[model samples]
Target chain A: MISKASQSFQVASPSVADQARLRLAPVIRIALLLAASVIMLAPIAFAVATSLRLPAESFSLPPRWLPLPPDWSNYKMVFQQVPLKSYIGNSAFVTLSIVIGQLITSALSGYAFGRLQFPGRNVLFWLVLATLMIPLQATIIPVFVLISKLHLADTLASLILPALSTAFGTFLMRQYFMQIPNEFEDAALLDGANQWQIFFNIYLPLAKTGLAVLAILTFNAYWNEFLRPLIFLKSIDKFTLPLGLVNLQGYMGTGSISVVLAGVVISLLPVLAVYLVGQRYLIEGIMMGGLKG
Target chain B: MSVQAREHPASARRPRLFAKLTEPSLAGMARRKAAMGYLFILPTVLGIVIFTAGPVLASFGLSFFEWNVIDSPKWVGLQNYDHFVHDSRALNSFVTTGKFVLLAVTLQIFLSLLLAIGVQATRSKILRYFFRAAFFLPLLTSAASIAIVLAYMFHQDFGVINYYLGKIGIAHIPWLNSSGWALITIVLTYVWQQIGFTFIIFLGGLAGIPADVQDAADLDGATGWRRMWDITIPMLSPTLLFAAVIGVIGALQVFAEPFVMTNGGPGDATRTVVMVMYESAFSFLQIGYGSAIAVVLFVAILVVTAIQFRLSRSWVFYQ
Candidate 1:
């Protein structure tokens, strides 16, 4: 399944030394992979390292690469000095609600487009795809106006309502539903199931994989979302994790880098946990989207 | 394409069921299902109408008027567009944005392609999964969090980057303070967070290539560079096109990294068009002008998408 291109370049000779060199090639490759991993993991690892240090070590000229006697108090300050707990709660509420909302809409619309015979199905789906053509940036200004007009600004509703608008989710579910054999729905209908019954009983049950994919992607996207929340939420109590961390950075006055970094580590915990745990599914979901594209 | 997939064997089966159900209520049953379909689609359609389509139309109308958040909009006509032509800051922001997009997206594709190839060519399951998870770790972290840590890590004095530079007998580089280096720093920050995405996509693309193709190439004595260029690359063209379109579109709209890192500082050197739009509408309260900028950006993106579609007809290889 795997071969090193450069090392395998001259494969004509069948000498013992050539075979030995071939055996040694993966050693060099693995070493290089480790080097790449260090570069890739440096920023986050450094953040974790900085977050663990006492304030005394933060200002070291060389900036201690390793935090000796990892200051556990920094984690405490993450809560005591800032509203990190509430910020996390707000982020979770927003992310979860958005995920639930998207799952419902995407599943329904995806089922409609993928299975149900309706007039203008193709045209309507194309209209949905047209939304992807224009940037969200263009639509945001007016959406902000509309939100403020409805007196929803400075509230989590502003974030959640617009967050629920997703063409990609529908697209993903439609593709998945299309791939499932139609016999499931047909057999259900033949058993006296109505279209709605077949949809709920037959289609939705078999769509666990699609729902999982949409849920994971939706959660990750909303949890990391910044620009919308930054514009929407006004009060300190209402700020999401991303907004709160940036605010914490500014509020720490550059003297408490350790505490600020602690806030970052705290903010990362939930999403990081989700990503690490559901990585296999999330990677597959992402790849599915890519291959279709 | 899905058109063929949508019209598979099950399609031929559908008419038989319809023919068997030739009751007088057949049309009524079909009508009921159609209504049910409408019911299922109402929420998404409503969202599309209210949030996406409505806002877009309103934005165009809003572009004709100058309004602060509190006051009524005053009509400005084409003055905003006229001013856009003369606005050096807006023009320069595009220049900076284009530069960042070119640097960041190009490097992202190159590094991600290399990483994907490397990750795919490794035999160990532990190594493959580890590399995938490690590289993708940053993507799960919020852009703001990444930016703050990166901004500190690139600090002129006590930054870890400079610390490493000194250890390697190199001079200190002004990563965030200088205008020239600031955008590059922002690009690097973005690349760090985003490369994993492209890498995963490319990895999927690479894995999609059949195993026997490699064996066939080996049999033909086209094992290494020759195989990659002549066979692998052509086969991966679809993924390459997909990644390029996504990368360029994403890179074009870069806001958070630059917004948090430089705040478009050192005399507007790192200012992106979206950041400018954001700053104008929110900070400067030039809603009309902001809308005009948004319109320009929309047109630019539309043109780019159209060009990509036209080019993909020729470039994207389908199995």
Candidate 2:
């Protein structure tokens, strides 16, 4: 059902030469697309290859495309050098908490805004939209102060607490809930089902895709989040994957290029796993959010 | 009056399912429904108030006072705002940020658009999916990880990139060591990870263009660039605007790339506004000045976004 954008930019003319060139256009486009893909993936492949090399071999001229015999020492060295396990655990815990928190808050509010009629529904939604424009960087100073005042500084809870609610997630779910037909709700209403009942039984079950999209996006975001953890968390044990990675690179005096690259590759695995499984949802979320905006 | 008789007027429009309840109970049910609506939205509203709205206002207030977290905040009135007049580093940081946004957003939009168009032009469905997935692969990794890898790859002395260039008889160029190349390297690192986002968005927009439009363009002998410029672009302008606006907003707040790649260094060459804010508040403990910087960035984002929308009115077409 998708249409091509007529990429052959040369003007169409009734000439054999032009027609021959037109026939060659797709081949050229494919070759270009192949190049783009290689460019896009090369850095990551390089990271993996570099991760398996020795310190001396890391900077070797005419860099080896492949690390033959695939040195496992660097991977072991990363764990020895840093509290890599704790970093991963902290990331997973914080990410899961934020995802669960956003799901609940977004779903409930989305249902309210989409299905239920209340006095200030429109105003509240506009307020939510306004929140989307204010990035964390703009408000982080006060957030940091507030967190510290609550004695949450240098804690993972500071990261999880501030990010538990997302304007983007709420808006996304609202769009999903709005798309569902009213007939289902009306039928449930005629059966004497309460709002809670209708929400749990009728709407929620139908909102699986929206929920999945929210969960996957939330997971991806917080799992890789660097800024919040960088600002809030202080102790090395409480550091997330991103922080640990930056730390690894920062201490590169003692750390080898191979070990640092190994840390980078290791940190990417969880996000990579989630992405591979929920790629469709991630794509759907981006398209849906983009089109709506 | 009898309960049913008196309630008959109010309950006349009600369904038979609710016929058994009295007028007061019906009123209570309506009240309960409203409360349920409020209840459902309570957590989100509370979060916004506590985390977003409250902090935003507090940040604005904090901009007016000098506080370093160790002592109580003192009122300085317009002093914090006045610092920007003489603060060369602050001004330079803003200028650097402006340069960064311009370079990153332009390259990102142009490359993603070209790639999206290329992917859309492919006749093979499997290859199209493969290309789209490949382009998006970088986005799956953390920016910290990407920057770390690139920092090594772009190293002047030992980088793989320079190694290859050396093989071709070109001298080793400083990627992160020099001011000029540092910013470009940061942009490249940022765009490499971020292009997938705009690529997917453009792909979605391309998919939405009706086949009939292309067919109609073909009938008029409008092929290739002519069709893209005249018909496809106009139709895709809405999505293009969306991608650009979002792209600009994101580019304006870039932190991780500069943070990990260069740490705002080789003389603050790639330092972003957020980096200044982060360093001021966290590193230097100048919370008030940091708050002022944040407030300015917030206003700049709002104004820029507004301008994008205002300008889009001229070119963005709706089908």
Candidate 3:
């Protein structure tokens, strides 16, 4: 026991020490993660902090980590300097209409593909899927021309109508609907309900998760949309949130940093609210879509 | 309900009798199905035709002719394609776009994977939710707002980044003004905005992995580094590949940030291919030339995607 074997045993025990390593591993990993999280969150937190600071303090030599006397007036000035309220209103109106339109169109089409029987349904569904491969940039010029010809340019209609139908939304809904048992609809049909009634009553309720996901995605897309609005809407009164923020640049320059920061904060609040409310559904929806891809 | 039964009895009776009359023929049922199906999908079909397919074909046709919105089209016959193929600006745009995509996608996928794994190890539900929300904050904010805030933050003289650099005793770098740094700043911004999405996808992928496999590996003297390398990485390859593909596609279309932040400036270092297409179509009114560039970009995406799929066969182990 007190021979050469004792030396090897001691070294082996140190190498094979599971309890110490296992206990230390997760703690170290979590600490590193927490540090990383702080780095990831710092800039956004700073942005929020700067928005609340006085304009002079925003760019102080040793930048203020937190404001002394928070200049809440920066938000007030943002509203006064730009048509921030109108922009928010327009964004909400357009985003809501687009989401509603997409919901109706996608649900109907998804039901058709998932449940209904027809000639060439597969072909049509595949055709819709094929459209997703084409980038939006390639179609923007023609879309611009089409909007101009319809005399919808410079109107919110241009923003709302074109985005009301998406292949991704339809596909997502179809996949979700297909997962639902047909027995529910069969039961409704046996009770003398018509197809439309069955869809509205049975299918729609069952597809709540899909609908929530679609609504969140549609709202996010419309809210963050920039190029289409930039090209189509000419009037400042009609500009959406993104366009308004872009125009805010002209007024603020580098001098009014606090006001600009306030614009960022103001613009993000609605989206943040939506994300918080629908976080669960959004995570599920994105995961579903990513898996198929 | 009683009023409908009484008033529309004849209409309902007729439909019932008619259905009985047509019950023998499968052709009638098939026709009914076809009609209902067409009715159900009509709106979506019409929307796609007018909005998506029509525009795609129209863009293709427009790519062969020269026309500003104010003037009639003039047939250019491959001239646009020739100009795009030989143009210096077009070449520079391709190079810049390539660099941005390579840098942004690689860094984004790597960081997201790391963050996702870290998130998986955490047991505190509150902290998990908080970190997830923090990561997703950038995605919810409008690109225009983020660009505005980041531009200020990256400002050379009075910006916070430079202020910190001075504190650390490093010389102030022109983050957006210099050509070399402008593209890198844009890339960093793109990565920051996109990492959350990648992280979420990886988290979803991580949750799908079986826990027993890890336990088996642990019992077999495979713990920590060996366990992760032998088990986790191989199992997570599908998610990695998916992220890589989407990340590359998104990176190639890097327009909004560069457009808002640098205007593709400081000698066009941040001028992505899409930015070039935007400028040509809108700024120069060269629709044909712009379309040609877009076509090239589209094909490049196809090739890159195809390459990814091909390479995925080797590394992507679907467990």
Candidate 4:
């Protein structure tokens, strides 16, 4: 409930001064937030604008914010000059593979940790928690060599294999599974369902929200991964979206910036599409990731 | 632990001796369940062992040897470490990263917090979602793409940013070329790309605060800045710590932004530790030296993270 003072402040008998201050507060707050959002949106807006600008106009003075006759040719030129299709396909394959692998691994492990009983459960859980702080960079060099030793380098396996599981995904799943009421598990046991059957039938179906969150979050990450692909993949045709776009930038270094912007637009399309499709899960995952830990 | 606690009641319902002697099958069932638990966790455990811990040990081993991929490694104990201590470029990279983290993380945390607070002021759901999407959209973008777009915008002669400054009667700033300005340009892009993620985290943090706490503060007549500083900040400290830790750890791994935008540029102005590792191992093929840098980076991250946690206790609060 609102405080008595706040209720009084809102009363019909309020003075002109109180009403003026009251009316101005939210307005100022809204204006400030709107201004900040405009700044945040500016880079993306500029990329799209430049992508549509005439190649020559990109170099013009007081650089144009709106491209008249909206040059669609730059995107076509990007397609011609760089293989956008292969990049997208490779990205999609690697990202999807990782998401699937992570889901299976995380779900099984999370179920084990959250519900199943075993010796050393607490110790194992701590190990999982500790891995959350281990940045991939710390271990990249040897993992690179490991991939090479396995003759997996330059293939999509190099990109997808090492990331097949993540501690964060496991931890997220475990926390969610922990919240499931024990009655479900007890009833399943009473029905004579074995561990795997109970997990697959009862727990997995009940964990749709957690699974959706993990998939969406993992997609955002592996889709944008640059360093791993940059290190692991060698061939141009094999490049993921970010790697291919950077390679294209080098080739287009002496050319107009509009073409690069066009490539940038293409690269961002899937991410934006995914976000629009699953904004709820993506947003919730960020909040869920932070506050839970 | 809670799951373990549930086992006690079940155990207590059985006659202990009979449960053990007559129900040998129960013991078998428990062993089977334990095996299942192990089976469930096997893949993730293997992942950690092979990909995480194994690489760390390999890095420590490789740091002592001088090896390129083309030749067999020759052990040169402490040479890379010796060179690292005197390497001006490596030292400068640390300084560059430090300056950046100091600037960018500070700005990111406070700006996102302020922006979140501003957004929270509104009651309109549509407006809130619009603003949320605007802020969060960049977190979905690759650093390479962001660097490409911003590089063009910060282009010295033909860049839109310079053109705008010129419109306002200010001299053009050499954003990526100048040693002084290049790191700032990198910092700006980092903040722009990442602040939104931090904003959402802060929004979550603020939203997580129980409504009654705010009502209580209001009843006590703690309005405006006093309420925020006294009430909101204390409550939000855990989120603040989280954002700060994440920001610092990520900043320590800075590579792609400088790599894509400036290529650690005009005079190594924006080169980071990872860039050094990258150029050494890949460009120069000095695997040993690169591994040494990687080891140093790993240690640096660990130490910095530890310090951040140690300091967080003074500020971060829990319910």
Backbone clash numbers for all candidates listed: 0, 2, 0, 0
lDDT of 4 by residue, B13-114 (tens): 666642332232455557667878899999998888889878888989999999888788999999999999999998888888888889989988877887
lDDT per residue for candidate 4 within A60-135, as digits (tens), equals: 7765677777999899988888888899899999999999999999999988888888999889988877877677
RMSD of 4: 6.4
Ranking by DockQ: 2, 1, 4, 3
Give me the TM-scores of chain B across the candidates.
0.90, 0.91, 0.90, 0.90
Q: Is candidate 2 or candidate 4 better by TM-score?
A: 2
Cα deviation at A27, candidate 3, in Å, is: 3.1
For candidate 3, the per-residue lDDT at B296 reads: 82
Q: Which candidate is the best by TM-score?
A: 2
Candidate 3 lDDT over B229-298, as tens digits, reads 7887898889889888888877877788998899889888888898899889888888777777877887
Assign candidate 3 its CAPRI class.
acceptable
Look at candidate 4 and tell me the lDDT of residue B228: 76
Q: Give the candidate number with the greatest lDDT.
A: 2
A27-96 per-residue lDDT for model 2 (tens digits): 7777777877888888999889988988778777677778897898989988998999999899989999
lDDT of 1: 0.82
Q: Which stretches of candidate 1 lie over 4 Å from their true place?
A: A1-21, A61-68, A290-293, B1-25, B312-315
* Candidate 3 per-residue lDDT over residues A1-293, each given as its tens digit: 11221111111124546556555666666666667677667667778899898877778777777776787989999899988889999999999999999898989888888888897999999999888777777788888888999999999999888888878888988988999998997687568666667778898889988898998887887888887887789999999988888788856788787887888887788888888799887778767653111
* Candidate 3 chain A, run of 10 with poorest lDDT: A2-11
Per-prediction DockQ comes to 0.50, 0.54, 0.39, 0.42
Candidate 4 scores a chain A TM-score of 0.89
Share of true Cα-Cα contacts across chains kept by each model:
0.61, 0.71, 0.56, 0.61
User: On lDDT, who's better, 1 or 2?
Assistant: 2
